[model samples]
Each structure stands twice: as structure tokens, then as C-alpha cells.
Target: MTMKESERGDGGPGNGRPDTGADERPAEPAGLRGLAALLRPRVSRGQLAGGVLCLLLGFAVVAQVESTGRDTTFATARQDELVGILSDLGQRSERLRGDLRELEETRAELERDAEGETALEEARERAATYGLLAGTVPAEGPGIEMVVGDPGGGVKAINLLDALEELRDAGAEVVQVNNVRAGVDTYFLDGPGGILADGEPLTAPYRFLAIGDPHTMTTALNIPGGLVKTLQGAGASVLINPRAKVTVGAIRSP
Candidate 1:
């Protein structure tokens, strides 16, 4: 027997298994040491991927939150604006209601008066019963005359109409501008201040007469916010006189 053969048969230095067992030990990581060794290759890749995924998720959440907040802010601002507008409208409506109530009260008071018949009624009665001539009647009364001139002092017809409106509000029964009588269908044009009553040209200083109570007619001429003041401000001369007697040669109301 040789020395090598004797040592191998007795297996004096190692187990019967060969040194190949040492290679198999590294294939699987069991304990802490094994785990550390096994992690070396994959640790870097895992950390990088996880970090990126977290960042993406965080960004998405932040964007969603910002969008929701912006939408809410816009909605709130719109609501506030609408509320402010409604409040302003409500105030205006209340004021208009108060004015309407006052007008109703005034109208009711007027309706209760028995002697408030118009001058036309008296004329009609006199013509039918007393055989009085319509055109030969001499009239004396109170009234307002409105002179409308252009904003440039050019005397535009529209300004005259503005004055006519004031006269109507003042309760004039007979309004004549230049030589034209004012009627429901009376109008004015833009050219030199001239009145058009049923399409007839009438002339200036537009004299108006009222057959009603003298004091009452005067009120229309001099009342606050009346057409006289407005026309005067527009560079037009408005003269209102309380007449003792106004002669109308053949003036008749159609």
C-alpha cells in the first residue's frame, strides 16, 4: 500500500464527502451573513426603482390636490360675485317698489276729487247745450313753455320734445309750440327746433296755454325737475307766464 492510498482509505483529514461541499454552501443564503452576501447585487436596483415609483406617486397626488383646490377657489369666487350683483339689484327693486306705492296713493287721491273734470268736457258741454262757438273762444289760463335747443345751442327739435315731456308731466291741457298744438301724436325732428303735430309745421317761443286752475297750471311750469329747468340747462330760454287772458282765434282740440 502506498501512503496516498492509505490516507484516502482511512479519510484522516476530511469527511468521506469531497471538497465540492464548500462550493454548494455559497448557492443559498440562510443566516444573516448569507443574506448580506445575497443582497449585494440586487440592493442597488431595488432602491432605485422604489425611489422612482414613490416620487411619481407623490407628484400625482400633489397635482390632484392642486387641481381640486383651484376648482374650489373659482367656484367660491363666482358665488361671491353673483351674490354681490343680486344684492345691488335687490336694492334697486325695493326703491322702485316704494316709488310705485307713492304713485298709487296720489292717483287714488286724484280719482276721489269730483271737480277734476278736464277743460275739454266743459267746452263740449257748452257747445252742445249753450250753442257756443268753438273757435271764437278766448282762453286765459296757466301753463308752461319748454324751449329745447341743441347741446351745441343749435336749437334741435328733439330738445323741444324733451321740454314738451316736462309740460305734459306738469299737467298742461293745451300746449302749443311755435304755432303748432301739442297732441298725443305730436313729435319733433332733428332739424331746427320745430314742432310737428299731425305732420304740420309749427313755429318758436312755443306758447302753451292751460284752461285749468291758474295756480295748478303754474305748478307744472315751476315744479322741481320740471322741463323748464332742464331746458334752461341745455342752453334754451324757457319762459312761463301766468296769463290773465289768452286769445285763441279759432283753436280747437281734435
Candidate 2:
């Protein structure tokens, strides 16, 4: 039972094995095989075109169905009902426009009213200030009340005038001396029995009501060489009382 060399396998020496020669073809890659299979044209060009046409037709049909459904609501509505809805919308729009106009008018009126009220208040304040300054109206505020006692009857008109000037310089807003309102044209003269303040006779113990800052007026009079010192040097008694509220009710006649 001997086999010839040619009958033996290629490995020789009684070896038996499958041949792996260079003439055999190599196996294709899995990815390339799949690509080649896909390139083999499983679907004809006419069939692919037909499928695409079918998909497009389906989409067109769906869109048309949606459009028809949307139109069906208004189509089924009664003509009179549609007209009523439109009329209601128009009325609502007109009412909104009217409300806007009314709001604008109200805002404008409020602005005008505010401006007018502010102007009126300012005018009233100016009038009050002018009246107080002109000695046409009574004034009351924190001020000093002075009583000058002339025991020797030696206080002349000039001394009184100097005191008035000092008070005016110290920011006295309103001054009244024994029922006589001091004005811009006020004058004093020595009368028969007493000194005359603007032609009005004021005897001993002349009372002065000055409306202004009490502390300021008090300091101004008490300074050295001031009204208080001058009056005291003249042998006249000066009594200055700072009052929280002093009224100059004497008004100058027009």
C-alpha cells in the first residue's frame, strides 16, 4: 500500500494537507462585498422613480386634506353667523380705539390741571410775600418785642430812627411801633408831649413789634455800639423780649 510521490500531498514525505498556492484568489472584504451587493441594482430605475413619486403624492394628499379640513369650518358656518362675528370684531376694535382716545384726553386734562394748580399756588405765595413786604397785610412769626421807656423824656426822634434802621438792617420783615406801621417813607418828629412815629404820637414806653428771626434781631440789637447800647447810653430803659410769636397787625393806609 505505497503511494507515488505525485499521489502524495504537496507537503511531501507522506504528508496530506490542502494546497494554499499563489494561484488561488483572495477573499473580498465584508464592507466591499456589501458595497458591491448594493451596486448590483436591486431596484430598477423605473421602480425607484415610481416609489419616489408615490411618496411625493402621499405628502401632497396629506397637505390637501389638512387644507380642506381647515377650510371646512368656515365653509360650514352660516353666512349670517359669519357676518355677526365680523361685526362683533369691528365693534370691539372701535371700542378699543375709543378707550385709547379717552385715556389720552384724561391724561392731557390731568396734566393741564396740575400745571394750573401749581401756577395758582405760586401766585398766591407771591402775593402773600408782597403783601407782607409792602406793609399792606398783617404778619406774625418768631420775633422780638421791645419796650423803650423814656423816664427822662430825653429820647428824641433821631434815636428812634436809628433803632428802626438797625432793625431793618437786621432783616426785619415787619415792624410796628405803637400802632404805627413802619413803611418805606416813614418819618419821626418830636411832638408836644411825646415823639411822633410817622405823625402818630407815641408817648413814653413805646412798644415795638418786629416780625423776623428772634435770635437774629436780639443779637443785632445787643451788639457793641448797636441799638441796645445806644439806647441805654441815652439814659433810656430798653426791655427786649424774644417772643415765639409776635404779630405786627398795624397796616399802613393806602
Candidate 3:
């Protein structure tokens, strides 16, 4: 009731009974307090945005590294291996060029051979034609043969000459009379007992071998007033035979 009692009474709220109201309030659990402190925001919007940007940049850097690895084929290859590959490619290119050169040479040779063969063939054809025309070689072709029988000695040199002229006009290339070759300058005359053809004596049954178109020669001789009719009128029997192949073996001396 003295000064100490007065001091206790002067303390506020329930005379300071060790503040029981505050102690009576429930104390928060340690785990709940720690959870609430972690949920409380410590960073601003700007700092959060900066953190997101840095994470994205790290991911981009990792993606770039992977892409570089995929794009370069020989990125991990050794220098010696690369050099060997280049050498192999050079060898292959050289082989291809060699094959192309060989093919070109073969084509040129074939062309030259074709030209030479053609020229040789033409020369052979010319030789054959010249030989036939010059009467320097034996010739055979489709033609006609005439056998004249003069029983009454009425077939003279003039009759033989007329027959020869008609044959030449009818496309006769080569002509022979009684095994005597008839050239471009042949003549006929009346001999002692027969007719003379190209200065060679020819008796009755004068055989004429003419090389030409058989049908044309036969038609020319057997016309209405042709050489066959004239020879028949002179009391001479003429027999003509068309031959598939007529050989004129008689040749003029060169």
C-alpha cells in the first residue's frame, strides 16, 4: 500500500500481470511460419523478367551448339583422312577422262575406216565397168543368141552386116560372131565360101552372141519389117534363143 503497491496499480491493463492475454494467444507453428515467409514476395517484376531472360538465353546457347554439330559433316574428321578422300576423288576424275579420250579415238578411227572402205568399193566398181567396156575381160549377162542357116548361099556379107547393126541399135553391149570378137571398128565382106566378119571367116549357121536386155533385142529383130524378116526373105532361116546368161568369152587383144 505504500509506494510499491502504488507502482503496480499504475501499470496499464490488468495491473501488468505478466501480460497473460498475449501469451494466451495461440503461437504459430515453426513449419507454418517458414512456409509463409517463403511465399512472401522478395523480388520485384523487373528482377523476375531478368531471370526469365537469362534462362532463355542459356537454352538458346545450348541449341546453337547442337545445330553446329549436325551441320558440319567432317567437323570431327582428321586432316589425313580428308586428304585421302581428296586424292581418291582426283583418281576417279582422271580415270573418267581417260575413258572419254579412248572413246573419242575409237570414233575417229571408225569414221576413217568407213571413208577408206567406201573409196575402195568405188574403185572396184570402176575397174569392173572399164574392163567390160574395153573388152579386156570376159563378160556375161542377159541377152540373145541368133543362129542363121543359109542353105542356098544367099546370106551374104550385107545380110550379116544388117543383122549386126540391128543388134547394136537394140542395146547390145557386147557382140560376138562365130567365136570372133566384134569391136567398134569391125567390118564384114563376102569371102570365098562364106562371110567375113571382122576379117575372120564365118561359114553358114553363123552364130551371133549378143549381151544386152534379151526382151529388147528379141523384139527389135522380130518386128514386122525388121532384120529377121529381111533375112528370112533372102532364103535364110533364122532361129533366135533368149538366154538368161550369155557369156562372151572372146576378148580383143590389148
Candidate 4:
């Protein structure tokens, strides 16, 4: 073969085939070689571990700095705005506390007023009952009727007063003599023509109406040595009648 054919039979530099040589071997990939160099154990195990810890500490310091920077943004905000927010919260809390206290006071006051009203009502009821018993008010119930006929005008004021005492002792709630109210403080005086009770003149044949239990009043008057016997000894005709219902429609002057 000629020299040109011999050169052609050998692969040219531009050909896809690799050059063969006894001193050359296949080259490793660049990325794989770099990875192998990094993984190669060149230091002690303790030294490697210390290097990784330092790297993690650096990353943590960087994160802390970023977080502190964000917090400083709020700290550098307007002083007036921060003060106003805190003041508003404090005032709202105080107002709520004041409202709660006022409600409690109102409830306590209402309870006290209710108790006072009940006590006042009870006192009024007691006053009314006493007024009725004292002959200051008109009364009506079963009682005894007495007719005293003093034909000789011999019924003295003392005798009338004694009879009133006897009737009161017999549970007489109210008494009327000749349509005149005989109260606890009533006075009887001897007049020229007849007897005067509470400044009102009374004629003869005095009619006494008392409000009480009829049986009790009758038994009290009919007892031996009672006011009836005394009045008969004074030459006054006395008659007592038990009535199922008797009314003393006279009220003492206020």
C-alpha cells in the first residue's frame, strides 16, 4: 500500500474513535471525580463532626439576626401610637369594672327597699288593729245590749263609769252609750238634766251597745255581784239582752 493509504487506514484525528495507547486509560467523569474527592475521609471523625456543628451554628445566628431585625421594626414605631393603644385598653377595663360595681349596688339597694316596704306594711296593719280596739274606729259584731232606765235621775257619773269598766273587762272591743262613742279616754260628767259623755249630753233611758262575743258578755254581766246587781241597788232599772249582731257605728273625733 502507498503511504497515503497507510495513513487513511489509521484513524484520523477528527474520527469518532478514541486514540489507543499503552500508557493511557479511560478518564473518569468530572462530576464523579469531584464527589469522590469530597467523600474521601481526610480528617479524624471528631474534626469532621466539629466542622458540621460550626456550619449549623452559623445558620442559626443568621436566622436570629433576621428575627431581631423584624422585632426592631415594631420597637421603632411611633411612641404616641403605642401609648394610645395601652391607654385605651386600660380605660376599657376600668369602665367595665365600674359598670359591674354599679349593678351590684343597684341590686343591693333594691333588696333593702323591698325589705323596708314589708316592714312598713306590717306596722300599718298593727296600727289599724289598735285603732279598732281603742274605739277610735267603728266596729260591728255579736255582743250584748243594755237598757238603763233611771226614773228618778239617780244614775250618777260614777255608776256609768263603773259599768263601762265592767263591759271592757268582758272583752268589749267597742262601746256606745246613747249613740256616743266611749273610747279608752272617754270622760263622763254629771249634767244638770242628765249625764254627759265626751262633752255630749245624754238623756234618760240610756242604751248601751257593745261589740263582743254575745255569750261571753252575757255571762260576765249575769254573774253574781256583777254590775247589774250594783245598778239595781242604786234604784235604776237595768235590762241586758244578748244580741247575735250589734253595731257601734260611732267613731271618736280625731
Which candidate number would show the highest TM-score if scored against the true structure? 2
Q: Clashes in candidate 3: how many? A: 0
Looking at model 3, report the run of 10 residues with the lowest lDDT sum: 14-23
What's the lDDT for residue 76 in model 4?
Answer: 76
Tens-digit per-residue lDDT, 1-254, candidate 1:
88677666744446354555455655444587777887777558889999999999999999999889987864667777878878999999999999999999988878755345655677787774332122223344443333333335545566667666755565555555556555566677643444454466655444555434456666766678766666677666765566655543334453
Higher-ranked by TM-score: 1 or 4: 4
User: Where does the lowest 10-residue lDDT sum fall in candidate 2?
Assistant: 5-14
Candidate 1 regions off by >4 Å?
1-153, 192-195, 250-254
- Position 160, candidate 4: lDDT: 91
For residues 94-207, write the lDDT of model 4, one tens digit per residue.
999999999999999999999999999999988878877676777788998999999988788888998888889999888999978988788899988678998899887989
Candidate 2, 1-254: lDDT as tens digits: 45775565458543766566789888798999999988996788999999999999999999999989988886888999899989999999999999999999999999999999999999999999888877888888989999998898778999999888888888898899888999888889987777898788987788888988888998999998888888888889999999999988899876
Off by over 4 Å in 3: 1-86, 190-194
Candidate 1 Cα deviation (angstroms), residue 75: 99
Clashing pairs in 4: none
Model 1: residue 42 alpha-carbon error in angstroms: 99
**TM-score for each predicted model, relative to the true structure:** 0.37, 0.66, 0.62, 0.53
Q: What is the lDDT of residue 209 in candidate 3?
A: 95
Clashes of 4: 0
Using TM-score as the yardstick, the better of models 3 and 4 is 3
Which is the better candidate, 1 or 2, if ranked by lDDT?
A: 2
lDDT of 4 at 201: 91
